[model samples]
Target: MTAYTATVTVRLKRGVLDPEAETTKRALSRLGFELEGLRSTDRYEVDLDAESADAAAARAEEMAERLLANPTIHDYEVSVEER
Candidate 1:
């Protein structure tokens, strides 16, 4: 097995209400930062052993689907690299 690192990024689906991001955007605007929009995400890095990068990605994707992201409201992406 090869050591790999999987990075999962979870975010709210488009059209969902992200109050935290909206508050941040308002705060930034108050601070004179101009922006078209803002969004928030949660990133998780997992290190483990897998037979291949594909396997690592698959495992990470499963983890995201099962726990990291809420299927009803969140979307997630998984990326894998050698550790």
Candidate 2:
């Protein structure tokens, strides 16, 4: 097995309500940052041993689908790199 790191990023789906992002957007506006829109995301990094990068990514994707993200309201991406 080879050491690897998987990164999972979870974000709300389009048309979903994100109070945290809204609040941060408002704060940024107050600070004079101009933007048409904003969104917040959660990132999780997992370190594990896998046979290949593809295996690491598959495991991370499963983790996102099963626990790190809500399938009904969120979308997630998984990336893996050698450690």
Candidate 3:
């Protein structure tokens, strides 16, 4: 098996309510940062052994779907690289 690192990024869906992001955006605006919109995301990195990069990505995707993200309200992305 090859050592790999998988990165999973989780964020709310476009129409979903994100209070944390909204609060942060308000804070930024108060600080005089101009922006049309803002969103917040959670990133998780997993180190594991897999047969190939595809396998690593697949595992990470599964992790995101199963636990790291909420399917009903969240959208997630997975990426893998050699460690």
Candidate 4:
């Protein structure tokens, strides 16, 4: 098996409420930063052994669906690279 790195990114859905991002945006605005909108995301990097990058990405996608993201309110993307 080849060592692989899986990157999982989780973010709120378009219509979902994101208090943390909203707070951050407000803070940035107060600091004189101009922005039309802002959003936040969670990124997870996982190291594991897999036969190929596709396998690694598949595993990461499963991980995201099972724990990294809430299907009802959040969306996630998975990427993999050889390590």
Candidate 5:
């Protein structure tokens, strides 16, 4: 098996209300950051082991879909780099 680094990005779906994101945006704006059109996102870095890069990526995708992201309300993307 090969070790890999998984980069996972999670975001609210378009047209969905992301209260956490919105709150952050407002906070940034209050802090004098002009974030009128800013959107918020979350990222995670994970280390995993698999037979191949493809397999690692598939596993990351599955992990996001099943645990990290809400399929009905969020969008998720994952990339894996073999080590």
Candidate 6:
């Protein structure tokens, strides 16, 4: 089996209410962050044994679509890496 590295970024889907992000943005603005279009997110990097990058990416997508993200409100992106 070939060793593969998977990286995923998870975020609230568009049109979903992000209370945490809003609260954080308010706090940041209070602190003079002067930012716009604030967004909150999570990221993960997983190492696995797979035959190819395409396979790894497919598996990662399934994992995200099934477990890592909420289809109604969350979204994710996956990428496979060498080494």
Which one wins by TM-score: 2 or 4?
4
Model 2 deviation from the true structure expressed as Cα RMSD, one decimal place: 1.0
**Model 6 residue-pair collision total:** 0
Candidate 4 lDDT, 10-79, residue by residue in tens: 9898988899989999999999999999989999999999998998889899999888888999889888
Better of 2 and 4 by lDDT: 2
Model 3: per-residue Cα lDDT over 29-83, one tens digit each: 9999998888889999999999999999999998998899999999999988899
lDDT (Cα, tens digit) per residue for candidate 2, span 1-83: 99999999999999999998899999999999998898789999999999999999999998998899999999999989999
What candidate 1 gets wrong by more than 4 Å, as runs, is: none
Ranking by TM-score: 1, 4, 3, 2, 6, 5
What is every candidate's alpha-carbon RMSD to the true fold? 0.8, 1.0, 1.0, 0.9, 1.4, 1.1
How much lDDT does candidate 5 score?
0.87
Clashing pairs in 3: none
- Candidate 1: C-alpha RMSD after superposition: 0.8
Q: Alpha carbon lDDT of residue 65, candidate 3?
A: 86
Listed in order, each prediction's TM-score against the native is 0.95, 0.92, 0.92, 0.93, 0.86, 0.90
Error of 2 at 14 (Å): 0.7
On residues 1-83, what C-alpha lDDT tens digit does candidate 1 reach at each position?
99999999999998999999999999999999999999999999999899999999999999998899999999899999998
Flag the better candidate by lDDT, 1 or 6: 1
- Please say which candidate is ahead in lDDT: 4 or 6: 4
Q: What are the per-residue Cα lDDT tens digits for candidate 6 across 1-83?
A: 78989998999988899998899999999998888868889888889889889999999898898888888888899989977
**Model 1 TM-score, 2 decimals:** 0.95
Count of backbone clashes for each model?
0, 0, 0, 0, 0, 0
What do the candidate models score in CA lDDT, each in turn?
0.96, 0.93, 0.93, 0.92, 0.87, 0.88
